[model samples]
Target: MRTMMTRRQLLQSIGSGFGMMSFAGLEAASDPLAARQPHFPARAKHVIYLFLNGGPSQVDTFDPKPALTRFHGTSAPSGNLKTERKTGALLKSPFAFRRHGQSGLEFSEIFPKLGACADDLCVIRSMYTERPNHEPSLFMFNCGHVLPGHPSMGSWLTYGLGTFNRNLPGYVVLCPGVPVIGPQLWTSAYLPAIHQGTYLPNNESEPEKLIQHLRNRNLSAEEQRRQLDLLASLNRLHLEREGGDAQLEGRIQSMEVAYRMQSEAMDALDVSREPAAVRARYGDGDFARGCLIARRLVERGVRMVQVYYGNGQPWDNHDDIQIHRRLAATSDAPMAALLQDLKASGLLKETIVLIGGEFGRTPSVEVSGLVRVQNGRDHNNHGFSILMAGGGVKGGLAYGSTDEFGFKAVEKRTHPHDVHATILHLMGMDHTKLTYRHAGRDFRLTDVAGTVVRDIIA
Candidate 1:
């Protein structure tokens, strides 16, 4: 009979994979959230951003305007300051709008699944941005400025709250091809290089390629562990000899996380491990998988997960509105499933979910209306719609609205800064207080403007 190996001897000879399954081992398993402590106890420990990429038309999805149906194919009621395009008569949504849940919130048929979760959602109908174009507006929405060079919200979260998961990055971004502005939306900017989001490609669900730079073939698990253990010891010895060096210390910690992540991160993003019914619910598509992965990462203590819906202007339907119908279908169910799954798993109470784009489309048709069938609208920056749920928001509520014809935001308007402020509030960080001294002045996610919308808070 073979003699039983001691714990240390086993670790030296075998791998940590088998050991990571045990609770005691997991407890001893390097705490992933070592750096992710919030400034205070937070209402939301995690965030999932359902970015719609190019913009979705409000009239066709969340906000319905019967008034527009009354005047379809004619110039709208609102005068001047209109979209800078060929104006057409008001066009009603092609799909029907029905009141859902006890909230009686009206959602167009385009997103049947998301509408079901209406009671848990706080839809902001009067969201407005400063840019009508895709790139600048996208940047502004994620980084707080139309130009890049600014830390993204995720970066800010990591900087302020640290991270719950040391093995994985504090923030993760899932995109297939590219967002309108690409990496700028998740860049670290003035923050430390480590605060930048870890980008996971859309098709990375494959076991072999799920995580880049994590698959190492030259060494066995025991060999790698030995190397990291030796390196960590050397780092500690050097730190003690040098007295104290923060930069060197941070590097030491980063190296340890990178070493341990080979096992932890791989398991975190493996969507294949999900049961068939579970995968089917999210839909067997890139966006769907992205949503599923978002849940897994956040559950594993990742702070923020941004799931971009499609590649290169999927929602930028300028010439054909019907084409948008397809894009809408692609995102609808997976987004809804993410919410439902989170709720059932009891994660929704502490996880904030957001859905919107850079801006919305014009109420009036611009291109696809041969003189009528698909009346595609131009990009509209003056007004749009955004949805929020969980993370300390009161559900079954609509914070603001546009005009009767859905031309512009008329009341209770919420700006991008307000959204930024609210998110920080949920994370227990006062947007005003979470500042970093850089470029000769203190910088923050809200820049110089931001007021947490008190009305939306429960």
Candidate 2:
């Protein structure tokens, strides 16, 4: 019979060889949020994803399909695309489109503010996903899989690049209220909990309310530091007695970070300190305030910051597609302000900005059995549109295209995995090389499939 060697016993046998070196490596790995080097020189040091929670109608937004008007209320072709609900005849966009910027990128009337800044935007009109439903598509966008229990793109970035600022979380998610799938969308499944996005409800602009329990009312800064040091020492002693545990080490590191955050987080999250003109530029509202804070966070060295549009699929206009104009109104000013501010601050050169949702709405009008919807569209995973700017992406260029009817991606089609790969590439990470071994297989953000869309790179 062969006897199995315990980890301690194996370490004892290898003590004279590489035991000390191995222990040193383990200690270094303890601080999961500690900054690490990228695979190569990175074009984007930070990322800010403006996630429009519900699928936005591409035909009504970035992609202008005049063909819809030509075929409006007419049914001739029997091969129309199927959707989540039974759709009526083609619906023409109520809003008008006008060319903007030197690129001649067309923008709908609703996004006049964003349209003015069109030169900096790279609109991809041929984007598609695997699912049409919110839950699966949301998971697909954030975690790279239709199913849950996978690390999100933010988590992967933090895991790969670690954190630039220890005082604040490397990955931050700002939403006024929970989206449909909730925290699972930002979860760091299979990755260290520390890499999970730090969710902040922007409903209240108060810094204290945004970051609950940020300060200890009873303990002064010095006293809190002393307490943290003692607690860390005790934890270290316990770790030495019980071999190394990743979870325990993570908890210890989190405690240390929490202690440090008490001093800096308050100042970082407080947007009221901004100049009056700057505050006025971003406007007043949870989404707008979240955008301002996102800029502030990226400026302070946070790796990835996601500002969701609003709570619970706010853009899912089932009854009236005209509601899109209202939603766009709320977003245009803040988004434009963010881009302009980043450029003025010179942060735009090093930060990547992504805007879009999980999927897009169908071009044809949708009619549900449960209710009557006159102007709204159904979910369309066949095609969608998203915009990217800054980083290393070419500005003022629209890549790929959808068909004339705007029902599907017909030319130079791109998938979410491809986008993920492109994003990691911009961040100087080879999606294939950046992998975590689990379940006896190497898992990655791109999964088994992903091809970097290199043409968009500046």
User: What Cα-based lDDT does every candidate model obtain?
Assistant: 0.80, 0.86
Worst 10 residues of 2 by lDDT: 1-10
Q: Report the C-alpha lDDT of model 2 over 1-458, residue by residue, as the tens digit.
A: 11123333444565555333433243354456678788889999899999999999999999999988999987526546877887878889999999999999999999998998899999999998887799999998899999989999999999888878878889999999999989998987877667788899999889999988888999998888768766765665565579755566667667776777886788888999899999888888999999999999998889999999999999988778999999998999999999999989999988999999989998888878744657898899999999999999888888999988888999999999999999999998999988887677888989999899998989
Give the per-residue lDDT of model 1 (tens digit) for 1-458. 11122233334454545433432243254332345455577788788999998898988888888987787777765552455456565666777899999999989888889999999999999998887788788888899988879989998887777677667888899988788778888987766656778788876667447666776789997777777666655654565455555455456556656676887888888888999998888897889999999999988989899999877878877666787778878888898899999999999999999999999988787743333545587788888899999888889998899988776899998899999999999888889888877778888889899899988887
**Residue 368's lDDT in candidate 1:** 38
- Give the TM-score comparing model 2 with the true structure, all chains together: 0.92
Positional deviation of residue 9's Cα in model 1 after best superposition, in angstroms: 38
* Stretches > 4 Å off in candidate 2: 1-30, 76-78, 236-246
Q: What is the alpha-carbon lDDT of model 2 when measured against the actual structure?
A: 0.86
Q: With candidate 2 superimposed using the best TM-score fit, by how many Å does residue 201's alpha carbon deviate from the native?
A: 0.4
